[model samples]
Target: MKSSLRLLSALGLSLCITTLSAKELTVYTYSSFTSSWGPGPQLKTLFEAQCDCTLNYVSSDDGVSLLNRLRLEGASTRADVVLGLDDALMEQTRALGLVQPHQLELSNWPLNPDLAWTDTDFIPFDYGYFAFIYDAHKIETPVDSLEALLNSDASIIYQDPRTSTPGQGLMLWMQKVYGDDVQQAWQRLARNTVTVTKGWSEAYGMFLQGEADYVLSYTTSPAYHVVAEESDQYQAALFTEGHVAQIELAAVTAPSQNVELAQAFLSFLLSEDAQTVIPTTNWMLPVRTDIELPEVFLQTQPQRIGFSPEETEAGRETWLRTWRNAVSR
Candidate 1:
């Protein structure tokens, strides 16, 4: 009886060890990334087949909020990977040392060099230009530039600069357009706003509901309507002053015990399968030039407007203050 009991104990211990080895990778990301329409579901399905591990997503409001939450969690963070931050937030994120450097070789991947790859920590996954999306059916004449957006009486919906990436992009884009007079520009633009939301999804939803004439959204947003809904009524207005290109990124956390698994997933992000999933799902441009984009992508005349990591880090607080002061008027 004693020998049989000891044998059962050994078998139970082996089973426990086997179960513990089945890794569950925790990914912290923006809500949009894990949305039904986003590439998250498809990508998760694809990666899981090869990984022999389950992916667990803990989605936050947006990229900034994700980073803020990580900061709060610090060394005790459960996130093995984070997949929504943009280049604008790179410097700040790197400074915190919240994530480990992505050790992947870019030359071996489908990585785009035009993303202006600067940080060794954040890996570029997808990108798009910030633009005012308007339903062509609603407005006869869309605003052509930031100057027109400010001068016209068209009601717009935008995210708040404090909480949203697009909102941050607008503030920075305005800085590029108006130079030292950005505050005056915001004051003028604020009069045209219907309401400010905390994130991109909320602002875009209001526009879609006809609550506003235009929305602060990506140039690629129309591609979703063009391809999936088979509708061409929505379009991004070309701007003379230019649009800010936002490159969304992914990074592995330093505190994660599943580093190899997290890194493997990061590698999978650059795969052709993942790149193919981005355009219509995330409504963003794939980093790989190999994928054939939907024809609606032709409508997006994206202008490059980005800040270096150091430059963004330095002026972030001052720019947010300017945005606050302008909107208050």
Candidate 2:
């Protein structure tokens, strides 16, 4: 039965691959996900092998721009699918009615509070807790918590909340940890911020270039150094206040000519074959529990403080204003 469906899916899954090719599916995505080094390249190869379709990716600067690009294009977009939008922006994406609803099946999903994402329009593929990463060789004393980050004098690089998801996660983390004093907290953090870039790729690159002592990144970051580069000199600081959880997702655009095929692709994203590549390629946790991770990831993944749709919608303006006012000075 499985082999037969696999064969049929390839024949039927072709949406919009290229010019004059009807069996193609165009996906709008963030650069990192589609970069030759990122999951996008492997994803296209693997999915196409099964779907008999050409998978083309039109990448934006980052996830925020990924959505903004869609909003800017409105209904005329040729993209049948979107990958790399996060739980943070789902409220805006859903409110804008930018995507059609989907009910994709899952494997290794659970009934846990942390895994509960109720939106039918967007499907969660993977999740990770946001953290500040540092070079063990550079900083003898790594700051752990939100308060620790602000109070310490160590130089850091982070993304702009208006442009990057991890930067926005840090903003929300500060708000969640320091509710009424969010403004005061950002004021203090701004003192330590050496530079703020427009996207994750830039910020992480700056850190790699030794622009700062640390950079805002995922807990799974060190796993790359440990597993890929055969180095153990990097680490994610253990925080007193748990880190903010970011669930990365994919969705079918409302204007798509093919619904079931798009939905099938979303399902393919969560399957073991795809999830297996996500941890190393995308540098985040796989949504499936049974998938084994590099022991480094298991050793370093932080505790999560999850958010709801309501909380995300209610907090965007206040968080952005607080971050902007503190740093603009």
Candidate 3:
């Protein structure tokens, strides 16, 4: 009886250890990333198969909201990894000191040369250029340039600069195009502006419902329509003023207990298997160049023009103020 009791206790302790070792890695990201249609489901399965851990995603409204959520939760956040922050948010997120280095040697990965990635803390997974998407059937003569769009009375919808990356991209684009006259440009664009949404999904959905002639979104937005719906009605209006790029990044949270697992997920993100899932599901260009893309993905490359990550951080507050004051009018 004594021997049997001791053996049972040993088995119970072993079971506890096994349960503890089978960990769960929680990643904080945007809602779209974890949606059924997004890469989250497939990525969760892929990562779990190798790591022997459950991959969990906690989502906010959008990228900017991801930063806001971190600020609210700070060190108390349960996130082992934070993903979906764009390059523009890098400086702000880093200043919080809530994220640790990924510690992976990316020299072997086939990162895009155009990215010129040198940051050690944040890892870029995907990128896209901001553009105004319009239905080709409705708008036969779409505005050819930002100046033309602003100069015309064509109704438009865009995301809020404070809450959405694409809206921030448009803010940077306006500043790049109009220079010191950006205030007047915003005031001008406000004339025909249908509404400013808190997130990209709302604005894009409104556009799809024919609420506006054009909607501010990624250049790759139409790729989803072409590939999934077998329709090419949606199109990005290329601007002669050039477009700003949003590079989505992921990093290991400093407060996480699962540092090894977080880093593993980040490493897996750059792998061919993961990169293959990003383009169609996320509707963005993969960081790796080796992935073969659909014809629509190949066609949307526009002239890239925007502030560097440092420049964006420096002027962000001032630009936000300018946008708020102008749009209020």
Candidate 4:
């Protein structure tokens, strides 16, 4: 009878270990999640509960840096999945062959059916328009357009595109607006500049701390200031030319050993619950059309602007060179 009891106990322990092992998955993303208000922990908890897999996050301060790391790690990368890459870096990600096609079960997703990538190389999770966030109290006539920023007296803060994703978005925004004459646009913008930071957090933090009157950030930036920071002074400007919209995407890494689990996580990210959480925490508009936006978002709807990823990829180097020249001049 004692021998039988020992065998049962061993079997139970084995099952527990197997369960624990099956309940873990690794994800890599941008480092915005380290904050209390960030979406990392909440997403992890929800995904784990639904999929029975624990999410292990590895994050970096910039999306480009994260992609670079994935390239460096190659097939031996510890991450099963990667998130937070925007359309700007899609070419680099694809060229590096860092990610593989994920056939997610996305029946309930309310994405723009025409806009969704047919190849399934990456799935867009959330998106928002890039704009300048400024203190309303400081400036009497706030810069209302991209051109206004170039012509404004108020100091401007922005991130360096080579090192930051928002910076890339802003650069791409200029390219979209200025087109072939982008060099001239940068020349004009450089004249009214304060200085560039390394990332969005630094630029936005400095703006909030009164270091600059205006900082380049997302349209939803003011949402956080209004709701969480409770600062009525901050507001995101609406550019007459329209702001550049960046779509954040997630994908299963090519090296992932557990492709099915990674695909399940990707599908979950597009679900209604996850989409609902995106606007509040990540300060991004949901890609899932069915998700009801918060009251704050309803009041400040971001203007939609379009740009070709191919155009951005082709012109990025030239644009940056022109911007550098403009800044130096």
Measured by lDDT, the strongest candidate is: 3
Ranking by lDDT: 3, 1, 2, 4
RMSD (Cα, Å) for all candidates, in order, is 8.2, 3.9, 7.8, 7.5
Give candidate 4 regions above 4 Å deviation. 1-22, 105-107, 112-119
* Stretches of candidate 2 exceeding 4 Å from the true structure: 1-22, 107-113
Residue 110 CA displacement from its true place in model 1, Å: 3.0
Which pairs, if any, clash in model 4?
23-54
List clashing residue pairs in candidate 3.
Answer: none
lDDT per residue as tens, model 3, 1-329: 22332332323212211323438999999988999999999988887776677888999888898889988898899999999999999998898897888776666577999999879899999999999999999889888889999999899999987888888889999998888999999999999999999998899899999999999999999999999999999999998878988999999998989876677677778878889999999999999888999999999789999898899999999999999999997
TM-score of each: 0.92, 0.91, 0.93, 0.87
Worst lDDT run of 10 residues, candidate 2, spans 12-21
Local distance difference test values of all predictions, in order? 0.82, 0.80, 0.86, 0.76
Over 4 Å off, model 3: 1-22
Candidate achieving higher TM-score, 2 or 3? 3
What is candidate 4's lDDT per residue for 1-329, written digit by digit as tens? 22332332323212211222345678889888545678887888777766666779998887877877888899899999899888888877887789997765344456856456554688888887788887788776787777777776778889988778899888888877777887788877776677888888888888778888788888887787777777777778888877777888899999888776676677767766677788889988888667877576767665667567776777778888877876777
- In angstroms, give how far residue 119 of model 2 lies from its true place: 2.9
Residue 234's lDDT in candidate 4: 76
Q: Report model 2's TM-score to 2 decimal places.
A: 0.91
